[model samples]
Target: MSAYSQQPALLDPLPLSPPKKEDELPVALQDIVTAAITEEVLGTVLERHVQAHKPKEPRVVALTADSISIYYLQPVREYWYLPLKQTHTIRIAPLLPVLPVDASETETAKWVAEIKDRITRFTETKDAPVDRFIPPNHWGDWSGVAVFMGFTLLIAAYLLGVGVVEQFVFTTERRFNIAVAVHCGVLIKRSKDVNEMKDLLDKHWSGDSKGRYLWVITSWIEGWRAVSRLRREIARLNLLIAAAEEETAKGTKKESKKKR
Candidate 1:
């Protein structure tokens, strides 16, 4: 026998437990099992069912070790995931949920405690990324400077009776248009690249506020174009109506003369 054989045969290593199947998971977590498996982060999922808002629909939330995903099943089926590494803030309400009528007071308290403890542990262990807040400028930035210069130029032009300057600068609508144009021009000139503009907007606005502002600006531009097109169409229609009326009048006069 070889030297290795002389020693007692090593016992077979303890077999590792097999991973849990999707069917074995709790009912609340069954829907997200496929998504979790695809992401390869399907370790353990803790779920809670609660109403998202008072008047809105309820949602299911699955909390993993590294991520929290919310599932909305009404009006539409949607899944949203927020990774622990990317989230910056987590706020839990004091009275998070209303327990079922069948649940005892003690059982309800215990359930709420457990949920809060789990969330607290996960957050303490996996901290979200820190945000760097950029201080906003006072009144000496490029935007401010551009606005001041544009206002001064508008006033000077109005005083000198420049072409349509009084009409544009004195009226509320035209003044608003001029201000919007100047501000947009300044923003474009100040931003060296697309990334810079995005960063600047992110620094100033949080969540969907930035997107909302962009949407409003885009809608305004599109609305202006639509209004202009409608005006042109109306003018063309009016001219056609006038020409038809003139032709009808001429035809009536010719018919009356032939009758005489």
Candidate 2:
């Protein structure tokens, strides 16, 4: 046979005629991948995200999953259901580079070294908060982590007692997207000052964190520094509140003296 004629049959197109279907696409999705996958997959992809990129003792903003819990370090941080039931599409980008079949051990090591370098891309979602304005560090606050609902409730109680939040909310879903942990009451009662704080949070606090392992903020990885920034922000805000109160007091005192 000629060289072209002698090509392996595997390279040739199959001769069988295929059956044709209707041109109309199905309206409903037969499979809900996230839901269907839930049991088979050991956990959600947050594990993959963390395993690849080790964030600062990595305290970032608390996101909403509406009550589903997962141990952050256990490689299953959080999950939510998507009810897409049509011929739509979602794109996924993996953090870690796929190992080349012929890559050397040195190459593998280098790839591992690049994990931290790859963090920003995975983190900077459209609505993801920025990590630009971490306040100056001081001490002794671990309020970075909380039992998601539990912590917010506690804060609501605290703020309510302090008279900051008269009417409050527990979940932050309606206000911000992809939060790690936030002031629930502040979201509910959005004042100009609160908006400024929110702006600071948006620009400074990162949602890329060690993650709330079991909804508790105890996983301090490389992302720990970020938590310190969060703490510093709390300190700065406290100082500002103090300064505002002092100014208000001074103004009142000056007015009283003038009246006298």
Candidate 3:
């Protein structure tokens, strides 16, 4: 006979045993299955749920006025970027409100304690990027060329102003934008700087900065305020979620006990 079979041969079918009730799924699993079925009947968002759970690669992140970048630094550098025309919410840790403290309260000796309560009621948000737009804090405040057009006497004044701004400026003259970034309402990067990170985008990205200026001023004005609020609101929501999860766990335990 050839190796390939053409005739139907004969083997008796194996007897199948009936499923056992004891071998059935647990009560919790049953409940979950029921809920899932109800959801599917009502038109489930299974696609979005699957997409949300898909694994993501580890990469470095950088942001700019126009786009956010995700890139690999080693193993042959590669980049992935998302363009921005919409406002994104981020939490700024560097801008947390500062409280006045006593220096002598610690083991380390200090002759004087800082009593600046007025510093607590700051009118401007802390660690904001527009801080760079303020005079003295403004860029090229050193460029003297950028600011005063390099007039001989103005140069001296600019240099002196720089010293004053550095040595004597209050806590309000924040000159950087370092924060945790969130996209699509999901927090991604823990520590990042929108102002400083843009240099990387400029270097590696070939995209034009075309539509940036249109919303630049308006967005910059609102940027820090949104971050500050988002930070607080996120913290508040976290507490609520934790409480809900705890309550759910308690209810589940009670149901299991009742079933037993």
Candidate 4:
């Protein structure tokens, strides 16, 4: 026989063992399996969860390793990311394109304590009206009382001014004034002032400003346009972050399996 034919087949099937009871799988293992399948279906969403678990990578540059091993018992690294393709695994020398440092044990402990404290406060404060938005407490009830008193005072003032003074007080005028005041307040808060706006345009607006009218007109246009652009950019970044999270989760699962 030829040497190749004499060699045992690498593809030889292994003996099958009987299935174990459902409860035989450890709870942690079950959770891992569930997460992996979920990540497969979710696609992009896995990244967000992965990010939540990942350590903070300090360097801007990518760090590649032949293989990367993260212990389940240790919180040494943030998380181990694995790729989605079943055919390939980072078992040999996993390339860590990015290596992030996790928070120190002391920092993690402090954060956990703070979070627990906040949660405890929230739970304890739940029954108290002082902590609630529409609490049944005295303070909450006072808001309603104040609102009623305000309307009463307003009506009394209007009656005194209109009936006693014989001044024309149209109902529409009051409504229009209120609406204008509310809308104007919102706009004022949303809008940047002239000088600040001008400075913003000068700092970031990349366009020509040749003449006096052109400079003023361009500055105004560019500033508002820049604000709108910035808003859109922020929204785009949020979407990209969401997508990245999904990939990271899938990667983590593969990393876990490779360890096994």
Best by TM-score: 4
TM-score of each: 0.20, 0.19, 0.20, 0.21
Question: What count of clashes does model 4 give?
Answer: 16
Instruction: Order the numbered candidates by lDDT, best leading.
Output: 1, 4, 2, 3
Off by over 4 Å in 3: 1-219
Superposed model 4: Cα runs more than 4 Å off: 1-96, 100-171, 193-196, 209-228, 231-260
Clash totals, every prediction: 0, 21, 1, 16
Query: Which is the winner by TM-score between candidate 3 and candidate 4?
Result: 4
Per-model CA lDDT versus the true structure:
0.36, 0.31, 0.26, 0.32
| lDDT value, residue 150 of candidate 4 | 52
Give the alpha carbon lDDT tens digit for every residue of 140-246 in model 2: 22233333345456555654564333235324434323232454343343343344344445453443442222112221211333443443333333223333444
Per-residue CA lDDT of model 4 for 1-260, tens digit only, reads 22322333332111212223441233543343333322222221211212223322211111122211111211243234333211111111112222224656566445435433322222222111011011122454346445444544555566566553225443666664674566456346335533544543454334334422343432233333333333222223333333344466669999999999
Mind giving the per-residue lDDT tens digits that candidate 3 earns over 1-260? 21111122221111112224463334553343333323222121111111111113212122222111222111222223322211122221112222223323342112111111111111112211111111122242234323223232333443466664345432233321111111212222212223323432333222235423312322233333222322233233322333344466669999999999
Alpha-carbon error at 66 in model 2, in Å? 42
Best by lDDT: 1
What alpha-carbon RMSD in Å does predicted model 1 have with respect to the real structure?
Answer: 31.3
